[model samples]
Each structure stands twice: as structure tokens, then as C-alpha cells.
Target: MRANVDFEDLHFERRPYDPQVAYAQAKTANSLFSVEATRRWQDHGIVTNTVNPGGVATGLQRNFTTAQKESLDAAEAAGVFTYKSIEQGAATTLVAAVAPEFAHTGGHYLDDGREAYPVPDDASLADHPHGVKRWALERAGALRLWEVSTALLTA
Candidate 1:
């Protein structure tokens, strides 16, 4: 029942499948990967960052469960996010890729074309709509995720 970026139950082998929990875990993993990758490879000119393009009405959402769609609708209604066009969503990625400000910068999460504000790990989406949670940037968690992922790949 302990969701949210757990290494031991990473694949949900020990818990029921909850779409929201799975999505959250995946996002956390992405953030951790960026942090660890930057820490381990920045010296070699490699930069890694996580980007949240806000919500885009894309075909990918076709697979969304009813609960997922409802959650997104609620978030939108609460002003946590507004759906963006594909172009709008891609803009942030372009900024991360080519913006001089982000050049050589890594281990940061970008939202809406700039670095997202940092929020406490327990911060609610309603409180920090576009913020990056502290848990996502924790170095120890990032390192552990890196090691676990590497082991998975090698195994």
C-alpha cells in the first residue's frame, strides 16, 4: 500500500495497480534519474533535467483510465493546471534544450519553460501547482534509484 517511489515494490509486485500511484511513481523516478545522471556525468558535459510540459490534449491520454481523466479534470478545475496545445507543451522542452540559461544546468525540473519552484515533499498540488517536490531532488533517493535501476538493467 506504500506507493510513491518505493524501490522494493517498484514494479508493484506487492501492491494492487493504482493508475495514479503508478504515474506518480514514474514521474518521481524520472526526476531522480535526472538528478543522479547529472551528478554522475556532468563532468563529461552531460546534462539531465526533468520537464513537465503541463497538460496537453494528446493521443497518449487515450489510454487514461476514467479515474485518471477525472483526476486531471479535478486538477484543472482547481486551477492546478490548464491543458496546453502540443506546441505549447513542446515549448518548455525547447527551452530546456537550447536556452542559454539552462546550458550546462542539470538536476532541475522545468515547468512552463523555466525551472519550477521547489516545494516540500508533502506539498499538495493545489498549493504548488507547478512546483518540484523536494523528494524528487533528494540526492540519496536519486542515488538509490540509480543503483536499483542499474541492477535491474544488468539483471
Candidate 2:
């Protein structure tokens, strides 16, 4: 969502979209999107939560460059990243989709089938926090992104 803001404010020519950055930010926005959804629909028994279905060995890697694949493979070898099977990756999603536990923590971010803490701005953390960033939870930004996306869809 904020990607649109960056693209709009900076213009595509001035700030060409970085896929990785946009993707991370988009995931952040997704958490906020859930937050906004929870706020708006909680009264109707809708529980909206974010799930970090940990890395899966999906065809997503097809887009990676050979060098990127090498780096990822290295990370996997070093126990830094583990690409789960599709079934493993889908576990959390299935939980969030049907788990009664999520009904109470509607706005929480889940990882490994548990709610995770909000990660700070620091990018060098070794633990690789599996939670939403504070920026993604900002109510104003959520509402703004929702409005902008809605406008685009309507237009």
C-alpha cells in the first residue's frame, strides 16, 4: 500500500519500485490491512489476523536470479532460512483460518502457529523476528491505504 505512496510521491522515474522493498512493505501493509479489517468488522464476528506462513519451497524461487538462489541456498545450509514444504507452510494459514484461538487476538501476527512480537526498525537482527512492524500497524496509514486502494478499484 505504501508502495503506491512512494511511487506516487516520488514518481516512478525518480524512485523506481524495488521489488524486495515493495514486497516487504506490502506484507507490512497486509498486517495493517488486517488491523483495519478487524476494527471495522469485529462487531460482526469477523476475526482478521495476519499469518506468516514461513518460507515454503514454492515456485517463488523461479523469479530469483542464480546469484540470489546461491545466497538463499547458502542461508539454508547455514540454518538461516528453511524453505518449508507447501503443507508445512500452509499449516499456519489453516490455523488462522479456523483456529478458535485467533478469534480473541484478531489483529495479532502469527508465526510458527503462535503470535509473534512486533519487530523494530533494526534490520540486522539475527533472530529474524516474525511479527508485524510498527509502521504496518499505524491506524492512519491503514485507513489511508484502504482508502487509496478502494479508490483505485472503484476508478
Candidate 3:
């Protein structure tokens, strides 16, 4: 599924819910938030980053739709990804939170304990399993997301 920031229907209130699409959009929004937060708060010494804690079998999966479960199973069978243990999943997040190399930097997508390489926005997840999509960190989209989110909150 393509990760998109649909400015008009961000909340999906007017859209049909496809689990993959909604998840992708939500993840993109999260990445965009980190990008915009870093840009706006760097001067104040705030740091923010996105972390991909790759597929731990947590309670979060309890909500997975049948299609989502089948998709994950298929991807695993195809060697695209493997589920990590909870501890392993948290390792990447810990790297982002406390690693010395990440202390002063922000807005990077970290996976498997390091900054993930950037892939084109159109890159297939099967081809770049550990990569971050370019659009997820687009500065202009981040800025616009920040503005739109602010307006929503204040409205």
C-alpha cells in the first residue's frame, strides 16, 4: 500500500477503511510529525525520530484484519520479513532514544538499531524492507501536516 498524506481526509472519516492503506497513512503521518517536530523544535534542543520496531507479535496484532494477517504470512513466506522478539523490536527504539550517535540528530527513520537508508517514494516494500520512503520525510508535507494538525486541534 502507498503511504499517503491525504490532507483532505486525514482522519478517514469520509473514506472507506482498507486496513493496509489506513495503516500506511497513519505511519506516514507519524513520520511526517517527527520531521516537522524536528524542524520546528531543533532550535529549542528538542529531538524527534521515527523508529520501525519490526513486527513483534504484540497485542497490537490482535486488531489485524484477516487480509492483513494473510498479507503478513505471505510476506514472511516470501522472505520479505520475519517477526522479531519483543526485546529485539524494542532495540531499534532504544537506539533512537538513547544512542550517542542519535543524541543531537532528529527526523531520521531508524530500523534495526541504525538510521535506515532512504528509498524512493515509489519503492516496493518487498525490495526495500528496511528502508524509509522518501515521502515519509518530505519537508513540505511535514510542514503542511503540522499546520493541518494544529488547525484540527485548535478548531
Candidate 4:
């Protein structure tokens, strides 16, 4: 994706993954893309990073039935979790955009103005070396879906 950019007009934001499993994969992909792009364009000073705003009460929860939401709320109330308001939801994103600490932290995940932890040892990815390489492979698969259409139009 970085290989075909018009930097002067570059502006893009990815959607958040809803399902936890998909979200994890998306997060991983986001990390890899940022790392690979930064390495591929370090001279240009391009930066990329991931931001997780903990939990937010958003319309995305519409997919969850009332009972589910209630259960979630109950769980949160029990001190097992917490959710953020919309303003709080945007905090990490804001920090990512302007925080001095992030000026040099690339290919990392930030949450609530600080670096967040990654998922526990998942054997599927724990054994992999060169995170960016894995990301490139996954992104290559994603690119394949659009390659033909892009070629046809550009040609």
C-alpha cells in the first residue's frame, strides 16, 4: 500500500474491527503495515502506530442485544472492566497524533496516552520472527484482492 501513495494527498483511517478475533488480526495487520511502511519510507519521516482506546460505549455495540449490553454493563460495574465515553474514546487517538513521546514510537500500540500490552502468548504468532515480514505476507493477500482491479484501471 505504501508503495503506491501520493503523499501530498495521503489521508486514510482504518475502521475498528468489531469481533474480538477479527479485531486482533486487524490490530496485528495495522502494526505490521506501520512498521513496514516506516522502514520502507524512513527517509520521508512517515510514521504509523496503532491506538486502542480501552472500551467505549459506541453504536458499534448495536450488534449486541440488550441482554448482552446489560451483561457487559454488569460486568463493568463489578469492577471487572470499564468503558469510556466518546470523549475518552478519542483520547488515545489525540495523543497518537500530538504526543511528543509518540514522535519516535512506531509500530506500537498505544492506549489511554500510554503504550498498551499485547495479547498473551498466542502460539500462532508468538513463534514468528520479523513481525513486519508476517505483516507483509498478510497484506500481500489483502492486496491480491484489489491487484487486478487496480491494474485494469491504471493500465
Candidate 3 per-residue C-alpha lDDT over 113-143 given as tens digits, one digit per residue, 9 for 90 to 100: 8898899878886787789889999999999
Candidate 2 lDDT, tens digit per residue, 35-152?
8888888888876888888878777567666777898799889988888888888888888888878865587778877777766655432475465556667788778877877877
Point out the higher-scoring one by TM-score: 2 or 3.
3
lDDT, candidate 4, residue 109?
A: 62
Residue-wise C-alpha lDDT for candidate 1, range 17-102, written one tens digit per residue: 67667877888899899999999999999998998887788775776789789988997898776899999999999999999877
Best candidate, TM-score: 3
TM-score: the better of candidates 3 and 4: 3
lDDT (0 to 1) per candidate: 0.84, 0.70, 0.87, 0.56
Model 4 Cα lDDT, one tens digit per residue, 2-34 = 222221222233543234434445555555556
- Of candidate 4, the 10-residue stretch with the lowest lDDT total is 1-10
Give the best candidate by lDDT. 3
Displacement of the residue 100 alpha carbon in candidate 4, Å? 1.5
TM for every model, in the order presented, reads 0.88, 0.82, 0.92, 0.59
User: Which structure is stronger by TM-score: 2 or 4?
Assistant: 2
Candidate 3, lDDT over the whole model: 0.87
Worst 10 residues of 2 by lDDT: 1-10
